[model samples]
Target: MYQYDEYDRALVFERVAQFRDQVERFQAGELSEEEFLPLRLQNGLYMQKHAYMLRVAIPYGTLGARQMRTLARIARDYDRGYGHFTTRQNIQFNWIELEQVPDILQHLAEVDMHAIQTSGNCVRNITTEAFAGVAADELIDPRPLAEILRQWSTINPEFLFLPRKFKIAICSAREDRAAIMMHDIGLYLYRDGYGQMCLRVMVGGGLGRTPILGQMIRQGLPWQHLLSYVEAILRVYNRHGRRDNKYKARIKILVKALGIEAFAREVEQEWQHIKDGPAQLTEDEFRRVAEGFEPPAYQGQGDDELEYGSHLTMDRAFARWASRNVHPHKVPGYASAILSTKPGPSAPPGDLTAEQMEAVADWSEQFGFGEIRIAHEQNLILPDVRKRDLHALWRLACEQDLGNANIGLLTDIIACPGGDFCALANAKSIPITHAIQQRFEDLDFIHDLGELSLNISGCINACGHHHIGNIGILGVDKNGSEWYQVTLGGSQGKNSALGKVIGPSFSAEEIPRVIEQIVATYCAYRELDEPFVQTVQRVGLEPFKERVYARAPEVEPCAI
Candidate 1:
């Protein structure tokens, strides 16, 4: 994890004091609601459905055990007893009082954390794969470059106010776990044939009202020019992007209107003058930042496969959990385990109570190094657990309700705090998630289904990344009634695709059965061990749609 220096601490504390004054004025009636809107948003405070919600940034999804403890403490003492982990690798606290937010920010600053750039139309948090440094297949760690981006973008005067919020994701591995294809700017860090690390720059990708995969604007860009190149792209968007309508203000909209070739031309023209400037990263600077993310002191314990395999043979339940939740580590005798937040038939997706948070922190220190990670899928990760301790860790995780083995299965849902907490939501997302979880509570069935991602969003903002889910569910409002629209065949990763709507929206009560019918149709027609998305792609949506809407009257297919 990157520790905050004196400058970082000063900037955060100063912002906290400024926001404290602004909040005091707003509460004292010196500032109107309209006047306080942008100010509050810049500080990551939102006036949600029932109360204020505060989003705190967890940069690159890395957290030290001490920071995790502070988060648990915050959840225990303030607002509610739990917080919602978001797709942006951040956390949101609902039911926060307006006046207490300053104190909260102060508390966060003490731990080298803040709410800065978590919201509003500024470059938001720079995210990447949670398993960056330790992934077995990574070409190079992207965290050092991500940290550089974080430093350069924070309060940069040139882009303090863009037409819309900008999101950037970097992926070091070929697997694309960071969902780089669906970001405003996506960078793939890889070593070229020359053994030089270079970036594959992507532009115009985003999900929301208009979902589009980013086009590769530049390839084999030298590592040192990362900042200058990013600046050039942002400059083009800032100059040419629309401001008349919020929906048309994103860079994706601009890229579509002008076409990628023209967009690249513009960026190239701008880069001509800035490419060799001071903004171009230096080798020394790279080494300085890279030092922060250097591999931890790993012991040469050799392989623990013998002991681990014995435990797997002894316990079928543990084996099942390990199969789904564990990932391969780069080091021998170590593994990265994902602790599923989306347990079946109960607790809301992404909601972790204070006690659960503490338990995770304790477990991270006990089983691995004192470090933890948050995946974009809304799960916790212990990145360096020894293979020998896998059984002990599994046993404790089961006790904490973090032992669900459905990592890529149907029950491991990605959802946002919809109408239940967000004013922008059309319908409540938690109940819908609960309904689907209850319907597919069987682990054997989920595991057999294989590699299914079901994401639900309350509205079209795509906070849940529904557009990329294998089975996407978007909550809709029709004539003041709550309904859910379904989309099938959406996928994230190397072969990413946006899900297409199967048909018209269905009532809340009909969703669980509709999902069941879709699954049943899949089970009936699928080839041996064919995945859900592959089946949908191979057979087309007609069979699943017919089964899902078999009893309904004729209705036009919806698009989202």
Candidate 2:
């Protein structure tokens, strides 16, 4: 929600103009595909399996209703009728024409959004908790810091071409909803014992071919040095991070090679010279950024009866939806409603049509504040909805195909646009996701199972975040045939842990059954009301592995 100043506007406008010329040169045969690859990537344009994909940054996953409407317009005019909301809380249009990318960027710029830094080996979008401002348990709002980082990193000459893509996340809540531990740089903002705000900084966490949890480089860093400290870390990595091998280019690989202690020392050495420099945040700058995110005016109706129970009593379907989709808000008589785009059996996860986007925009204005949030789990959030309007909003969302009512259930899958779109994919992830959803269509059955995150990636890139799901499925190719490898016990939270692989790979045909076996094992072995993750952690992966491999003896068994 940070408003773009004249400087920000000029920067984007200049970049758009530069890219427009580049697109012209490419079309004119002056720039070959190889020559233009980095140029296009820097602008968040990727050449996919069938067409170009344009990823637009939704900074810190916050957008106003007008911005949402603009995105809907972009989807309708430039690309396909829908967009895919990604795990990083950005949105991608998978069927964009190469020539129309500049126009798309222009449209985004009009709304103070752009495709800058959404891709490439440079620092990507700075993400944070989707519920930053509104979360009841937050120690500090992270959006101001996220915005500060975004400004500092945008087209930074020193970091424009890093060894690999860098991702940073900031979280202010106790729950760690931002997956802070899995980012290249993660910041946990909290108040110190003396009531002064500070940041806990973690560096070098990422998932790809190699997944590693970030190491804490700095603890209790005063909030004033946020930008300066980040600059120091990036400067260290940009100078020394490997470039000879793409596989070893990430800061995680460097951190792993250097060891945490050495890395922390290097960052500290770098920081000592620069901590109190100009990049050190000023009180006025902080206030300016914070002002943009000032809490919207609320009626402040204390202890008002919401009359929401009537819907639960009158309609079983509504009751089921209310149980899963609605989350408690800190404010009295208010709630955060998750409008699930991951509908089962029919629609692919995170795919939303243009009309649906517009409808959601309308609903956000009507039932909530004129604001929307894109959660990292590929769901849309109306963050400040009145509890009294839940039923009406639910009905409108259901009509718009935006209401699946499965926020944390099995069918609410996180999947990448696999072979259907991504050039790097080994298999089609969407159809397989559909297959699984169709097989487990019962809402009660799914809810009863409870909070199972099934993430599928078409390849080891882990674009779907398979490494962090409760049931992680990664597609692989064996002798030109697509197969899947499963991992379990992974979670993204305050207690974040990477999942361990259960056993051998399964054929595409066998994936559903494999999943069923895994779920069945959970059902059989779980303690009272134990979630799948808790059960797996309690008994270890041995019990589930034994049952899963027993069903398919041909596949080799492996331990986590």
Candidate 3:
């Protein structure tokens, strides 16, 4: 994790002080609600349904033990007992008091964390693969460049506010775990024949009312040009992006209107002016930023296989958890372990209590390095756990209700805090998440169903990233009543694709059964050991559509 230097510390503390004054002025009637809106948003504060929500950026989803402890303290002291992890690799506190925000920011600054650029119509948090530096199949570690981009974008007056919120993601792994395809600017880092780091840049990807996968604009771009190229794209977007309507303000909308070729031309033209300018990354700066991500000292016990194998053979429960939660690491004796936040119907997706956060922080230090990572899937990752410590860690995780043994299964849902907390939500997403989680409580059943993703969003804004879930559930309002809309065959990764709506929307009460029917349909038609997504792809929507709509009530179909 990157330690904050004096400059970083000063900037964060100054923002905290400025926001504290702004909050006081708004409360004292010196600033109007409209006047305070942008100021509050710039600081990662939002007015939710019942209270203020503070979104704190976990840049590239990396956190040190100290930073995790600070977040836990905030959850314990400032707001509710828990916080929600988001798809953007950020965390949100829903029950924040307006006045206490500065104190919370102060606490974050003490530990080299902040909420800056986590919200509002500007470049948001720079995210990357959770296991960036340690993934076995990684071509390059993206965190260094991700950190560079984060530093360059933070408080850059040139792009303090864009027409709409922009997100950027970088991935260097063979698998697209960070959902780079769904970001405003997605960079795939790879090495060329001579082992020179390069980037493949994609632009105009976003999910909301209008969901569009990013289109690749530049390939084989030397890594040194990353900042300049990104700036070029942002410059084009800032100059021509729609501002008259919020819905049409996303880069995706602009890209769609101008076409990919024209957008690429514009970006290329802009790049011509800044390609070799001051924004180009230098080797010295790269080394300086990468120092923060130096590999931790390892025990180097590559021969832990015998002990690990014995444990796996002895305990079926531990084996199951390991099979699901543990991921491959570049180191011979190490692995990355995912601590699931979605532990059945007990908690909303991506939520962790203050105690849970503290326990995870402790476990990160105990089982691996004193570092934690937040996955875009709303899970915490211990990125360098030794293979020998698998059983002990599993036992501790089980005690905390974090060892669910369903990493890519139906029960491991990704959902947003919909109408329950957000003013923009059309219906409550938590209940729907609970309904599906409870329906598939049987671990064997969920595992048997295989790698399936179910994502829910309260509305079309896609805070939950429903557009890319294998089975996407979106909340909708019909005739002043809340209903749920379902989409099938959506997927992320190398072949990212947006889901297609199956048919008419169903009432909230009908969602669980609807999901059950969809699962049953998949089970019935699936080939031997075929995953839910492959089955959906092979059998298409007609089969699932027939089964779902057959049982669906004869209410007039609602348009999404």
Candidate 4:
């Protein structure tokens, strides 16, 4: 919700004009496809399998109702009549024309939005917890800091073409909803003994060809040095990070090669010079950025007349949704509602139609404040809905395809646009996702299963976040045929840990059965009400691996 100032406006406008010219030249045949590749990528345009995909950045996944309406308009006017919300809390239009992208950028700039840094090998959009400001358990609101980092990194001269794309996440709560441990840089905001805000910094976390959990670099860093510290880390990575091999170019690879102790030492050596410099935040600058994200005025209303318990007594479906989708807010009467984009038996995860977008915007305005949020799990959030309107909102949402009632369930999957759209994909991920959804259509069964994140990626790029899922599935190609490798015990929470592959890969056709076997093993081994993650950690992957590969002749019984 950070508003653009004059400098911000001017920079975006100039970039739009520059891209407009570049697009015009490409259309006029003045620029070859090879020549236009990087330019188009820098502008967030990708020539995908079907058409050009435009990824528009929703900074920290916060947007007002007006901005949501504009995005709906863009989906209607230009590309297809839908958009896909991604795992990074950004939105992508899958069928955009090459020539109309400049116009799309112009439309985004009109409302202080842009697709810049949404793609290419540079620092991408900074993500934070969706329930940042309103969450009941937060040390500090992280959006202001996320916004500050966004400005500093946008078109940064030195980092424009880093070895590979960099991702940063900030979390203020203990739950780690933003998947902080899976980012290139993760900052946890906390108050020290003196009640002053400080950041605990972690670096080198990523999920790609090589997945890693970030190592702690600095603890109890004063908030004033956030930007300068980040600058030092980036400078070190830029100067010495790998560039010869694309696969090992990420900061994670560098950190692994140098070892955590040496990397921490290097960052500390670099930070000693810049920690208290001009890039360090001042009180006025912090206040200026914080001004845009101050909580909206709310009336102090009691739950006397409200039917908080009555709704649960009246409707079972509504009760289930309230339990899963609704979250505790800082305010008494208000609650944050998460709208699941991974509706069962529909399109792949995060695919939302234009009408759905408009409907969400309207719902945000009607039931809550005129604001919305995008979660990192590819879901939407109405962060300020009242408790009284919960049932009505659920009913309306059910009418639209938006309501799936599968938050934190087995069917609520995280999958990438694999062979269907992505050029680097090894297999078709959507069909596999549909297959799993169909296999797990029983809601009661899924609810009883409890809090399992199943993530699938078509390849090792790990765009679907397979490395962080409780059950991770990665697609691989064997002689032009698709096979899947399954990993278990991964989690992206307070106790973050990477998943371990169960055993040998399975044929694509056998994946659903493999998942069912794993789930069955979990059900058998788990104690009363133990989640899949907990059960897996307690019993280890041995039991699940044995059960899953029991029937497969090709599977080898080795831990990943």
Provide the clashing-pair count of each candidate structure: 0, 0, 0, 0
Model 4: lDDT to the true structure? 0.89
Weakest 10 consecutive residues of candidate 2 by summed lDDT: 551-560
| Model 4 lDDT tens row, 340-428 | 88777677799888888889999999988789999988999999988888888899898887777889898989999898899899987
> Following a full C-alpha superposition, what root-mean-square deviation does model 3 have from the true structure?
3.2
Q: After superposition, how far is residue 324 of candidate 4 from its true place, in Å?
A: 0.7
* Tens-digit lDDT string for candidate 2 (1-560): 57899999999988999999999999999999999999999999998988889999888899888988998898899877888899989999988988888888888888888998889888898898778888878778889989988998999988888988999999999899999999999999999999998999999999989999888989999999998888888988998999999999999999999999998889889999999788888889999888988877777755334477666788888888889998777787788899998877667888888899999899889987789999989999999988778888889888877777788888889999888889999987998898898878777788888788999999989999999999999989889988899999999988888999988899888888778878888887788889889999999998788877784343321111
* Count: clashes, candidate 4: 0
Judging by lDDT against the true structure, name the best candidate: 1
Candidate 3 lDDT by residue in tens digits, 1-560: 67778989899999999999998999999999999999999999999999999999999999988888888999999987999999888999999999899999999988888999888889999999898999999988999899899999999998988999999999999898888889999999998889899999999898999999999999999989999999999999999999999999999999999999999999999999999999988999999989998888988776688889999999998888888899999989899999999987889989999999999999999998899999989998999998999889989988998888989888889999999999999999999999888877788777777799999999989999999999999999998899999999999988998999999999989998889888888877788888888888898899888778785433321111
Q: Would you estimate the TM-scores of all the predictions? A: 0.97, 0.97, 0.97, 0.97
Candidate 1 TM-score, C-alpha based: 0.97
Candidate 3: what lDDT? 0.90
Model 1 alpha-carbon drift over 4 Å, by segment:
551-560
Error of 2 at 18 (Å): 1.2
Error of 3 at 462 (Å): 0.7
Model 2: residue 456 alpha-carbon error in angstroms: 0.7
After superposing all C-alphas onto the true structure, candidate 1 shows an RMSD in angstroms of 3.1
Instruction: Name model 4 segments beyond 4 Å from true.
Output: 551-560
